[model samples]
Target: MRPARLSVVTATTVAVAALATVTGCTAKSDSTAGDGAVQVIAKDDACEVSKTEFPSGHVELAVENKGSKVTEVYLLFPDDRIVTERENIGPGTKAKITAEVKAGSYEIACKPGMKGKGIRQKVTVTGGTAAKRSPEMDAAVAAYRTYVQEQADETLPKVKVFTDAVRAGNIEAAKKAYAPSRIGWERTEPVAESFGDIDPKVDTRADGLEAGQKWTGWHRLEKELWQDKKLGADAKTLADELDKDLLDWQKRVGRAEITPTSMANGAKELLDEVASGKVTGEEERYSHTDLVDFKANVEGAEKSFELLKPVAQKNEPALVTELDKQFAALNTLLDKYRDGADSYEFTSYEKVTKAQRKELSDGVNALAEPLSKLAAAVVK
Candidate 1:
């Protein structure tokens, strides 16, 4: 998920090189005989292709593996369409791919090492039968459409419940509601994991607190601010710090052009804030009220995703379907906490308990997994 943090190691470099090769293409060696013929080569640990434009119809792609490692190539069309795919092209191997296509734009993606950071080549198809359509393509389109509809029907209402519980300050209910909420955002784990260390200091507090007072992560922060009365000024200060940090985080998260390095830096910064006690102040007191509000914000995000899913799916089925899965997981995780918060009544933060904190952490992780995946899937 999140493209595995884009390491600078040989493996990661090779993968990125491949991706760069495929995605960055320019027209080369144009000819009438080569009109319908496209040549793809994997070179310098990347996939490279000749001919950026062609007339649509029956097309043949001559792909040569020039890289040391084996690679697989996929021809993906605009709007999440996959025309055809070939796999297991060993070094020095060459393969020919034939498919009936129409005038449009398509991408050549190469998968190396069985991982997704593949090379993509852009191709433009011109001058073909305007009405030529295939039954198989139609079927795939229909199936994708149905999958998106089902996802929306199943996940939206549950997301609302989880968010409502968090906004209500019902920590017990929030815990219980987190499970279903997690499922709703399962596909967006990469994004959520970036915020995983929202409040790491709570681990120690959770271990030291009474059976019902233990709290961790966001839940721990909530208890510190709203449940624990001993931390007055400290809690307020921590809340202010969190507000600032979260605002910065929101800006980074909302940006359309986020690089793996930028994402990693953001995560490190958040973790550092928690480790330095900047989020909770010198007294190390957490804030329950702040936690509730943060959770609510997370819930609102889920709702926004639910609304966007349909439109995205209609425009890009394959991509949006994957994204929906991530959102589903996130929604499920939130549902667990919401349910937990609703099922129990805690008069004080001390009554929150260790088991609850553990559950909340696990739920958050579950949600984080999918968000991370979605981010990685679209990073390029």
Candidate 2:
């Protein structure tokens, strides 16, 4: 990952807020016999499935647990069907199962404690007796791999800049860099919260370089010092001691990461409906509710851009570049409908201004263009 270049002009104007709807689904399907072999491993709340492609029918699945904790894995099909399931596969254990499935889409989820959080791998099973790989599938997988690589490339360098700023006692820089660096982690909330204890105020100060400096970012020395609760006696000393706790709380909030999956999922679901033509009823399809959600997604993405502007300008040029494209795509989408018009409930082209409808259609298509490329890569 390379450092993102920060634009000074844009930094000062950035604003942060919750925006966008996350979207996605989980499902599984059967595998064909004698289709070579399929093996999947579950570890660290993720599933490493063998063979991105699957043939329809009864396929054997072998799952192994390498992590220390107990884990459960499920093979899911579309329509909320579970093709196969294995629970409480303890550390160093393995389980094998077989199931018959039809073609369409599927997902493999390895979850622990039924937390509704886990790694999901999308799978596609083709029809027919002979197992064959489609060229389109191959292209989609390649594209998805590229997308993941791009995101990783875009994220790490910015993270390094944020970490470096913290180490250098550059509080303002660190704060600016925190947003995008923490976006993915935030999606996992409680799990991401355990990463560290941070103090925003004292930690943000420039004096952090001094030998006896107050705690700053993640695991600063103060946490160990005050854990015993034997620091001081006088009011001034006790006040200083209490300040650490306060700072710790602030740090937690500052570094929190909210997962974007839900927002993405919501947007995709609505768009899928529009594409399929099932949502044709003007009253139900173009409801004001749909427009509100679309607006919210746009606003959310803007907020994300705002929060990361400072750091993004300086540390992650690629992300900034990609973001600009994303923004343009979204703006184009929003121009399609009246500010508060019920897009879903839109009965005919005449209901809204032609220009507005064209903008909306174009915007949706524009957003979907990049997203489809990106999605094709990930939702294999």
Candidate 3:
């Protein structure tokens, strides 16, 4: 019912297939043409932009991949909350992305191999009206933060259980704890991206990165524990690395800022992610935990929506009513996948039929349409 996030495994498909795009505050599957959108290229491990500077407000950057392999392009804030991204762009294709950026210094990243850090370009925006945020939006951010922190706090112990299993070379125990432990992290992923470095260390997959990028975290352990069924030295090291990073990350939570615009944008991005990764069954391919992340993303979006609801109810009661109905319908749909426990069963990625995927997609899109407009609707 709630949706997903950006990770390497899913992101590759995201670029070439359906990008996580924002339409107002909603997610739009199609490309949006900007009035004066500029062109950039992803070529042989570089992100080359048409210009280095621009006027702020509504800005569009059109990226084309001339590279031989798949690639991704992102407009990143200093904290690494992606302004907009076009992932999975294959050779000879292009992706058009637009964002509302205020005058400031920003970073442009072109992941040439769609792995690791691609080339980065620094750009400056000249002029634009400052975004006005309200207490309603602030409350939404605060609520989401509390939820994220709680998730992380609860997750640390579970992860220790998992890592301890891996450390002790207990593959059976490690496998059992995997998906459930990840749910805590996956739920708050929209906020997690702001942590930048920690995200990759904790979750990158082998196939998710460009050539030669080191894969680590849960998926790395997933391979040894599930695929190899042998937790070796490298596997233990990865588990230990994840152990330290998760603890350090919790310490950084209070320092991050979650604004109304980002929360609104994150809601749409989460659903867009569902369409790209979870529905396609590209994410958690090895672990078959796509459904787990999918549910968490939805829950995260709901937290964002709940915080914004009072504003919506005052401004547009009809829209609020519609959102409530759609969210319930979607959640009802997701609930069918529950494992009789608090978590979803998902069965297996391959077991999911085309009809099933479409059913989920259609439900998510229905909720997404009304969900996307919430931020701007409330702001107005």
lDDT of 3 by residue, 236-349 (tens): 788889989888878877666566656666676677667667888766767777877888778877877888787778888888899899889989888877765555566666
Instruction: Provide TM-scores for the models.
Output: 0.33, 0.26, 0.74
Q: Compared with the true structure, what per-residue lDDT tens digits does model 1 show for residues 283-319?
A: 2234322123224334433443343344434445676
Q: Which is superior by lDDT, 2 or 3?
A: 3
lDDT of 3: 0.70
Q: Candidate 1 vs candidate 2: which has greater TM-score?
A: 1
Worst 10 residues of 1 by lDDT: 1-10
TM-score for model 2? 0.26
- Backbone clashes counted, model 3: 12
Give the TM-score (vs. native) of candidate 1. Answer: 0.33
Error of 1 at 227 (Å): 20
Q: Which ten residues in a row have the lowest lDDT in candidate 3?
A: 16-25
Report the C-alpha lDDT of model 2 over 1-380, residue by residue, as the tens digit: 00010001111211111100111222223242225545767776456666556778555567778767767666665433345544556789876544445677766666643333345566667777632224443443343334323443454555566555545555556444543343322222221122222222222222223333443332232222223222222323323343444334333433322222212222333343232221222211321123433443344334434443443345445545665686676555555544335332212333546565555656555554333222112212
- Judging by TM-score against the true structure, name the best candidate: 3
